[model samples]
Target: AKYRINAFHELSERASQTYTTKQMTMEGVGEASRLGSKIINCKDVSYFWEGGCLLKEFSYNFQRFDKVEIVGRNGVGKSTFLDLLTGVLQPSSGVIERGESLVIGYYRQEGMDFTGDDTVLDIVGDTRLLGRFLFPHDMLNTRVSRLSGGEKRRLYLLTILMKNPNLLILDEPTNDLDIVTLNILEEYLKEYGGSLIIVSHDRHFLDRVVDHLLVFCGEGIVKDFIGSFSEYRSYMRDYESAKKKDSIASIKPQSSAKPEKKAEDKPRKLSFNQKRELESIESRLPELEEKKAAIEKDMNSGALPYDKLKEAAELFKQVSNEIDELETRWLELQN
Candidate 1:
């Protein structure tokens, strides 16, 4: 516990330094005199991988200055769809058209590789830009291998911005970034003139930056919603709750209509242990949901310590997974 406290203090100090450091800016340069209103068009696009459909007949027009986020569970083809849009992968069917003047910049989750011996100056030739990124002249000789995770991510982000792309695609860009850097990025994006598409699990980041969302529901389905991430989440909660109530109401009516089946014809009932487990799950579900809500509130509050924020993010994932599992089992038992 003492070591943890010390580590937190060190992280806090680093964050303070990062905050006082000079800020970074991004600008997009297009080849044409002016960019088209529709920067990209996805015409009935479908992508299949490993014998399974990732996206099916997806059609959307991406316009200049459009800030869109793609969100879904893990392994739900969010990244794959981005790849299709960026031309890294061909669509299984249909087409993706890009504007002639569009210059796209992509930031992948697996960041650009750096040789251990490469110095910060070697990666970024401009000392002024290095200073803007918190790498002063004294630290120019610092090797990439020795830089902290946050530092390396900052460097990689600088590289992406240097390209001056009209369309920016970022995949999980918030991971391993310091809060100060994240703030700067959010501020820059708020003023950024380009078309932005982001794939990130950072709910707070999504709520702050994007105007609309392309929700990747499972099974090759995506829903477009014109609202912030928090609003979408709240809407889904209400929708699911209403649907569950309807299901329960319908089930009760069915039970009243159905005659009692013969002993041999009735389906086997849940064992005693299963029934107890189901009851236990039902009792715990509300408590878990409340805990999850609290965690989410803290995440969006922007007041949590940097170290605690990382812990909360991980815990949030675990709690969400547990809830999903329990809900699935509860539905099975009800059936």
Candidate 2:
């Protein structure tokens, strides 16, 4: 009799849980259906600053069905594109057309600021939504000021969803988020019936979230590819490989006499400046890289005091820029 009662109770609990899940699922569907998007249209858009070109003559229609992932190698100004999209920085030329009833929710790399004393419940005013985002009941009464950086980032995401914006812009959204949180966030984004734009280096995240790409192919050119991130990468790789193969196939066998002439034409000594640069570049690059890594480690380690963090960050950026310049010079020297 006792065993039968226990089994019945377990089954009853599961049925109750299932009923609650059904309710939530229904609510989610209803919420998604109510959502919409704004048509943010860009025409002949270009951005240039400090006598350097970033993007030139780019065009796109950002709408509900479009999930655009901005991709570029570092220093190509993906952030500038984001600024253009969000109206933070006006384009150097061209027109940006926004929808009449557009609402934007932008999640930048920086964490959200929460001032004064406030509980988690006070912030969102709903625990079930928080639970959906991996916040448990124990975390409800926690003070806003006491939350960790990741927690704050997660909360900011939840807040964004709760407000139900018609357009969302995320820049490096996965930087500090845990995998579990990222999974849940991706799930939420899947059901989101709104326009979305993201700038991310996370391949997995890009593969899952975005359907189209705005690629910065260097030299102020942006290629709008109608495919996922993986597809674009595959296409580029295949193109490069075929190009290399064609070059190799085009090379005819050089005569022994031609080889001797080529050897004679080769310079016996590099210029004084070139020699000095070649000698020091190999050592200088490693030092700059080491300094960069050490600064990153200290920043991540939380060892630097709050006031010094900004200084460290600036120094790190300077060192990184130096490394990039030096590496480019080194490659030229090698060539």
Give all TM-scores, in the order shown: 0.66, 0.64
Question: In every candidate, how many clashes are there?
Answer: 0, 0
Please report, in order, the local distance difference test score of every candidate based on alpha carbons. Answer: 0.71, 0.68
Clash pairs, model 1 backbone: none
Please give, for residues 111-162, the per-residue lDDT of candidate 2 as tens digits: 4767649888888876788999888999898998998888988887777777
Please report, as a residue range, the 10-residue window in candidate 1 with the lowest summed lDDT: 15-24
Off by over 4 Å in 1: 1-34, 126-129, 244-335
Q: Residue-wise lDDT of candidate 1 within 200-272, one digit each (tens)?
A: 7665667788866787766676766666766665564454456546444444334445455333233345689
In terms of TM-score, how similar is model 2 to the real structure?
A: 0.64
Instruction: Give me the candidate number with maximum TM-score.
Output: 1
